[model samples]
Target: PAGRFGAKTGGRAGSKPGRPGAAPGARSGGQGGRPKPPGAKAFGRERFGQDLGPVRAPKPKRAGRPADEIDVHNPEGVRLQKIMALAGVASRRVCEEMILDGRVEVDGNIVTELGVRVDPEQVAIHVDGIRLQLNEHLKYYVFNKPRGVVSTMEDPEGRRCISDFLKNKDKSERLFHVGRLDAETEGLLLLTNDGELTNRLTHPSYEVPKTYLVQVRGPMAQGVGAQMKEGIELEDGLAQVDSFKLVDSTPGHILVEVVLHSGRNRVVRRLFDAVGHPVERLVRTQVGPIRIGDQRQGSIRVLGRQEVGHLLASVGL
Candidate 1:
C-alpha cells in the first residue's frame, strides 16, 4: 500500500508497487508546495511550429529609487518636470500645472510631487495614461517661405498654411516656427522642437541679429543709408539699423540691405516708410547664423548639426 510515492491514474486505487493514488488527507508530491508565482513557467505552452503560445505574466513591477532623491545611478537625471519640459511636450511652467492636476505619472503611478529628477529617455513617463516617447529625433529646419501663406501654424481664415508642408513629412514629432515672418514678408525662418532654444532666440532681450532687404517706392535723400544707420524716430521711438547698404537705386524704386538686432513689429518697413520711402517689399534675408542660402520659396531644409551649434553659440546659448 506504501510502495509508490507519486502514481498516475489508470492504476490501482490503493498504493502499489507500480502505481498509487494519494490516500485521503494526503497531498500530491509537489501539490502542497507554493502555487507557481506569476511569470514562472517551463517552456510555456507550445503551439504550432511558429506560434510559441502565450507568455507568462510579467514579473512584478520594479520599484526604483526616487528620481530626485540623489541616487548614484541617476547622476545626470533631472526632475520629472524639467525632464518633461526638455522633451518639448510642454514648458516647465505649464508642466507644473499638469503635475499638480494629477495628470503626470512615473512608472504608471501618479506622481504629484514636485522637484522629482528623472532621466527622460530612460524613465517610463506618462501623461494621463499615454506613454510619452521622449527620445524622438530632434529636428531643426530652416524654411524659405514665399508670400501668401500664413506664418502661423494654422489660420482660421482658411488661407494657405505653411505647416501643411510638414504634415506628412514629420509624423512622430512636432515642429514650431522659431520666429514668425509676416504674411507679406518672405525669407529665412528657423524651425525647431527645442523649446528652450526657441524661447531664448525669440525673447527680445536676447537681441539676436536679423537682416532684411527692403525695397522702397521712391528714391531716398542723399546719405539715407547713414540716416538709417544712425536711426530714425518712429511714432513708437527711435530705431536704428545695424548696417544699411544700397543694393540698388533708381527712380521710383530703391533696394537696400538693412541689418538690425532689435526686431519690432514690421520695424524695417516702418523705419524706411518713416523716411518718406515706404517699403513696397520686405524680405528677411538672415537671422543669427542662418541665411536664406539659396533656399527657394516654400522649401524646407534640415539645418546641419554644425549650423545649429554655430547659431546657438552665436546667441551665447
Candidate 2:
C-alpha cells in the first residue's frame, strides 16, 4: 500500500538515469549529495513549492450514498399479544394473561415475556403447538348484533348470545366486540383486537358519539325531541342527547334518531324512559365514525383503514 502511493514516484514510472533531480521513489539522495526528500522533516514540502501525486486512497470509495440502511421488508413489526389474538386464539388481554401464565410459546421456546415483538409471518408462535400468529394481518370485523345475544364474549349462565352467532363466522382471528349492547337491543357492533382504538372507543372517558334509532310507543309530537334534548335524570344521573330528531312516526309508534355520548347499558332505552316514552325497540344505527348504512342484521364487513383513521381522529386517539 505504501508503494502504491503515487506520491513516492514521479509523474513517470521510474527515476532518470543520471540527473541532479530527485529519483522517483527515494527522492534522489540527501541534501549533502542530491535533492532532499520532497516532504522530509529536514526539508519541508514548500522547499520546492511543488506538489507530487496525491496520497492514493483507492479512489476514496466513490463517495456515494449509503447502502443497507433500513430494511423495509423486515417482518418484526407485530406485537406478541396482537399476534396471538389475530391467530383465533383469544383476546389481546387474554393473550397477555396466557403469556404471563407461561402458556404461550414462540419458536418452540416458552416465551413468558410481555409485549415481545416478532415477525408474525416468519416466526411460529404456539400455545401448546397450536400455531398462533398465522392470521395476524391486523383484521377487523363489524357485526350487526341481533336481539337476545349478549354483547360480551361469554356469559356465566351460558345463555345464547352473540358469540354463538359468530361461532361459524370468519375464523380469521379471535375477535371481540368494541363496545357492548344489551340483549334486547339490535344494532351496530365492532369487533377487533386493535386495542388502542378499542380502549378509546369503549372507555366512557372518551364520550364518543353514539347514534341510535329508537321505535318508541308514542305519538308524533313537537316537544318530544326537545324534551329528550333538554336532558333527563336517570338512576345514573342526568344524561342528555346530543341530537334528537323525528324520523317517521305514527299514532301509536314513533321512530326517532338519537345521538348521545353515553354507551351506558340500555342507555337509549333508559333515555327514552326518562322522557316518559319508554322505547319499544332500540336499534343502534351508527357508532362513532361507523354506521350500518344498509348492512343487514348478523352480517359482517371489514372496516377500511381510512375509516379507522377517521375514528381515531374523532376521539383524538
Candidate 3:
C-alpha cells in the first residue's frame, strides 16, 4: 500500500512528504534534498537576513605587456616599493603611492600593483619617465672643486686634491673623477664610484659636452669666439669649441663661456693661449647635465635622482 501511495504522490517510497505530485527525492526548499555537511563554512550573504558589509568593486585588469618587454617577474625578488625606496626614489610609503598612481614602470609596463616583485639587476625601471639607478653601491656626486686642487683623488706632492674635499664620505668606496682639471683649473667635477659610467663620461668618443667659465685677458678681439669655433691649431692637433661666447668684459680681463666636447689635456687653456688670450682663471661650470650652480667651492653635493637620470641618459646608459 505504501509503494502504491508513493507513486501517487510522485515521491520515493518512505520519503518525507509535504507536497503531493512533487518529484521524487526533491526537497521542498532550494536545498536540493541534500543536507549541508557538518562543520561546513557559511558565507555571510548565504545566511538570510545577515548584513553583507560594504561591497567592494573589482579591480581593473592590467594591460598586456608589450611584445618587446621581457618577463621581469621574480618570485624571490624584493618588492617593488622596497627596491624603489632603496634606489633613493622616495620613501617606501611614497613609492607605494607612486606605484598605485601609475607613475612607475618595470620593463616598459606600467606597474600599479604594490605586490609586484622584480630583480633589480635584471629589470629596467623608470619613475615618472626617468630611468632609475638601482645599484645601491654606486655613488654620484658633483664636487665644486676649488682652485689649486689637483683633479686626482690623491696628490703625491701634498697639494690639495679631490680627496681632501671628500673626507666625510665612506672611505671604502673609491671615487674616481670623471675628468681631470689641471691644478690651476677649477669648477664642477664629477665624482662617482661607477666605473662604467665614469669611463663613458670621460672617453673622448662619447663627446660629453663640458661648459667652462674662462677668465682671460681680452682688450682687442673681434672674432675670437668665431675663431675658436672654427678651430684652433694647438701642439697636439686642431682643437675647436662647440660654442664660445663672451660673458663679461672688464678693463683688462674678460669672462667667456666655452663649451666643447674635447677631453684633451688643457684643451681650453691651450685654445685660448693659441689666440693670444691666456686663461687667467678657468672654472668648469657644467658637465653634460650636471651643474655647479651655487655650490660653494671645496664642497661636495650628491647628485639628485633626476640629475643622475639625465646624466646617464646623456651618455646612452
User: How many backbone clashes does every candidate have?
Assistant: 5, 2, 0
Give the alpha carbon lDDT tens digit for every residue of 1-317 in model 2.
12353454333423235345544434333232444445434222222324443343343222322222222213346777787777557799898778777787666767666646777667656675444325445566678888888887768988866567664544446676888888888889988876776888888888888888889887755687787788888898887899988889787898888899987777788777766788788888888878888988877788764465456556663
What are the per-residue Cα lDDT tens digits for candidate 3 across 114-178? 77788898887888877888777889988888888888876788998887777665445788888
Ordering by lDDT = 3, 1, 2
| lDDT for each residue of candidate 1 in 143-241, tens digit (9 for 90 to 100) | 888887777777898887777767576534677888777888989888888787788888888889999988887657788888888888988899999
Estimate TM-scores for all models. Answer: 0.57, 0.56, 0.71
Which residue runs of candidate 1 sit more than 4 Å off their true CA positions?
1-136
- Model 2 clash pairs are 23-28, 88-174
Q: In candidate 3, residue 211 scores what lDDT?
A: 97
Each model's lDDT comes to 0.71, 0.68, 0.80
True-vs-predicted CA distance for residue 239, candidate 2, Å: 0.4
lDDT for 157 in candidate 1 is 88
Error of 1 at 47 (Å): 73
**Model 2 superposed RMSD (Cα):** 16.1
**TM-score-superior candidate, 2 or 3:** 3
Q: Higher-TM-score candidate among 1 and 2?
A: 1
